[model samples]
Target chain A: QQQVKQSPQSLIVQKGGISIINCAYENTAFDYFPWYQQFPGKGPALLIAIRPDVSEKKEGRFTISFNKSAKQFSLHIMDSQPGDSATYFCAAESGGSNYKLTFGKGTLLTVNP
Target chain B: EAEVAQSPRYKITEKSQAVAFWCDPISGHATLYWYRQILGQGPELLVQFQDESVVDDSQLPKDRFSAERLKGVDSTLKIQPAELGDSAMYLCASSQELGQPQHFGDGTRLSIL
Candidate 1:
């Protein structure tokens, strides 16, 4: 059913610019939202996450903005760098469901030098 | 830093051949998960385990795929009579417990000829 939907399958941003990726979910029961970054030939790494109880959460250069009522969330990377270029995925989990993650399609981000 | 470990970073096998992948979650983690990621897509959960006991395997293809965490620490995933469509990256992740942040391994890239 594609419970999670992500936009802009790919993106390009100049160095020092802000990179944004958006995602939406269909399941209202989802309470946990997390973002992951993956390099080619590697598994994903946890980036930042936010719960429905908060509107936003930031860790260093990464930020996650979540809207509980709209069932949508977004990831923002400030001062993006070439090293930050990678595939980003958004995932959701409901505590009631044993915390099994449902992931988005993913967005390929390219940061220009 | 503790990290999940996976073996056989890459594997190439012909169709109908049997293949297996292994994972070792971070020490002290109590929850483990296996995921399959196709090219350009986010990972999908194949199975989840809590202390050597399966908590979820509904998405697993039981007819050909199997996974086990016999010691509540290391785990193995097997695919018998692999098909070309089975080509994908197998990732293993672990968390301290259900509803906690997950840490992933580098993953095993499987290519079925």
Candidate 2:
């Protein structure tokens, strides 16, 4: 079973529009959630993250909304720009040993100019 | 900015050939990881290391794949008698702490013919 499930394999948004991606995870032991952004021919880089203790976390234009009880989380991009176009992956990790991230399938976001 | 470094950004090899990839984690990072990502799929953990000691290799294909991190810094992954099914991206990541956000390298794109 996929530990984390992500929706809308691909998305397109006009510049300055709101772009959203959703993800759901199965393991409750996961306390840390991170979103990664990847471009073609590149490895993923951490975009933003949130803990279950917080309902939301925002860094600049990126935001992560988390729901502990539902075991779900989502990423929102405000005033999305063309530069925001890339593959976004949601991941989870429990405390300790750095077991490597349990990642989502990834969503390809395209921001129109 | 400090970043993880990986060698042989791209490799093309015939089936049953031996291939190797290398990674150098960021300085002062204590935890390291190897991941395999297939097309249209999420990255899967191949191995995890805490300093110079392996913490997990359960998902690794021991019959043909091997990995090591000597001196608690650089690492290498070797695949002997590679199969066509092995065509995928090999990614390396490191974290400053056990549960911290990981930083990734650009990854080695392996194409096993």
Candidate 3:
């Protein structure tokens, strides 16, 4: 109930290929889902977020797919590039909370040219 | 680019030593947070402050950790008699209002010897 399990502890994708990271959360109280990107030695920053009301949200080359019934969400990266190589984290937050973000262990993504 | 600011990008201390970190949130942000991220894991929330009062500190160690935001603009996190297991990245984030997206700082990488 407290953990958001993410898959593929590490991922390797060829340039221009698609990179997908999945996360499954057990808490149905989580109303907001967000993905964060963190570079080496840097803090994780919000990349994109979506509410449960929306099935999907697209921001530039990144997209978030939410499944209410499945209690799962994913982050999709298109045209993977070396610059995009970084650790991606999937997070969840319950409504009415001021600033609490429960995050997954994280997925290390490497895009090879 | 008004971003959350953190001090002493890195710190190396020995066991039983004391360590401190500072954070200046973005202007007009009323909510602030402190998070600890161990290597190979996602960030974990240690505390949350609303303006000058602490709204939550459920996960805070309490034994050796304490935080405060006197003016609600700048905050500090302190640890006394630090242990080796305490070595990790300390992150600070702030949001404009409740339930809003938070902006994070680069974070302080602490290595306890």
Candidate 4:
């Protein structure tokens, strides 16, 4: 069973537009949500993250909107640029000793110049 | 900025051959993870370690795959008699402790012929 599900396997947006990716989880135990960005031939890097306590979190041009009641979260990029084109993955982790992460299938975002 | 390190950025081997990958987590990090990412998919955890002890390895294919963190700092993952299906990217990540955000390495891309 897939613990996390992400929509839109791929997306394309014009530069200066807003790009959005959505994710949902079935495990209610998960409390921490993180988003990662990866480029071709490179490993994934942390982009932004949010907790159940907060409804949203933003860093620079990246933003993560979380809905604890719906067990969902979404990533939004404002003023998207070609440099922001990459694969994005959403992952969740529960509290306690186990820090293992459950990841979504990922979305390939392309920002047109 | 500190980052996770992985060796052998790319490897090409024939089926049934033995292959090994290495990883070094960021200094002062206490948790380490090994993940496998197939094309068009998100990374899946293969094993996790806390300090020098293994915390989780249920998803690891014990019949042909093995991993160890002998010194609790650097880790090695070995696959014997590799199969064509084993062609994927192996990623290593580390965190300061359980439940913390993880930092990832560039990963080793393995191609089985």
Error of 1 at B2 (Å): 1.2
After TM-score superposition, the amount by which residue B57's alpha carbon in candidate 3 deviates from its true location, in angstroms, is 0.1
lDDT of 2 by residue, B3-22 (tens): 99999999999999999999
DockQ of 1: 0.94
lDDT of 4 by residue, A17-110 (tens): 9999999999998889999999999999999999899998999999999998899999999999999999999999986538789999999999
Residue A99 displacement (Å), model 3: 4.3
Error of 2 at B14 (Å): 0.7
Q: For all candidates, state DockQ relative to the true structure.
A: 0.94, 0.77, 0.81, 0.88
Task: Provide the TM-score of the second chain in candidate 4.
Answer: 0.99
Model 3 agreement with the true structure over B1-113: per-residue lDDT tens digits = 89999999999999999999999999999999999999999999999988999988999999999999998889999999899999999999999976899889999999999
Show pairs that collide, candidate 2. Answer: none
Per-structure clash totals for the candidates: 0, 0, 0, 0
Model 4: residues with Cα > 4 Å off, grouped in runs = none
Which is superior by TM-score, 2 or 4? 4
Q: Residue A28 lDDT in model 4?
A: 90
lDDT of each: 0.96, 0.93, 0.93, 0.95
TM-score, chain B, predicted structure 2: 0.98
- Please list the residue runs of candidate 3 whose C-alpha ends up more than 4 Å from where it truly belongs after superposition: A96-99
Report the lDDT tens digits of candidate 2 across residue range A1-113.
99899988999999999999999999898989999999999999999999899999999999999999999999999999999999999999887534458999999999999
Docking class of 4: high
